[model samples]
Target: MRLNHKYFSNLNNIANSSPQGIMKVSILESITNGFHLCCRSFEPVASAHILKELDELKTKTKKTIIEDVEKVKRLESEDRNALNRAVGIWKAGRDAPHKDAKFATDASI
Candidate 1:
């Protein structure tokens, strides 16, 4: 039982030390973390563009759910379905926005 206890202790230490293990598995959470990394890893203009896209994405998501409730409810079935499709498109565009973005080798320079 002593060996098993030591093994579990080592496993716990490894899990606690890693960000992946400590952080919740979530897209928004990951995106926020990515934003921080992007700021440090990219140049000013590149970072600004990437941050702008991410901020717009977050703002659009918030406004769509909170500010557009009435607008969504008033839509016809077909239109509502189209809106849902549009939301999916928006989600798909999230990665596309930064796919072509290049990171600076010496961002701090």
Candidate 2:
């Protein structure tokens, strides 16, 4: 929470660079630079392959979501109609020859 307060208080741009903040930033920068150095050789090829695959995956995911949404919408009215039919059937069951059996009066679809 302290991290959140510090971050959101200034929209992630710290107003004051205290000694602690400076040290933290320096450590982070050093780590980032080290990683960058390690990946420098493969950065170009790996980035191109990874980004293309990521874009393809994103497009497929979006298309699948759209299709699922349409399917659910089509089923929604059918589900409502089925529910109404079930309630009507249950109401009809009241006519059976069982004096002790009772269906709730407040059942509404």
Q: Once superposed on the true structure, which residue ranges of model 2 sit more than 4 Å away at CA? A: 1-41, 84-109
TM-score of 2: 0.38
Instruction: Tell me model 1's lDDT, rounded to 2 decimals.
Output: 0.63
Write model 1 residue lDDT over 1-109, tens digit each, in one string. 1225565566556656678544322322334455543343346656788999999999999988886776666676679799999999999898576755766874754
Model 2 lDDT-worst window of ten: 7-16
lDDT of 2: 0.66
- Model 1, residue 36: distance off in Å is 24
lDDT of all predictions: 0.63, 0.66
Which 10-residue window of candidate 1 scores lowest in summed lDDT? 23-32
Model 2 root mean square deviation, Cα atoms: 17.0
For residues 58-101, could you state the per-residue lDDT of candidate 2 as single tens digits? 99999999999999998998999999999998888876677754
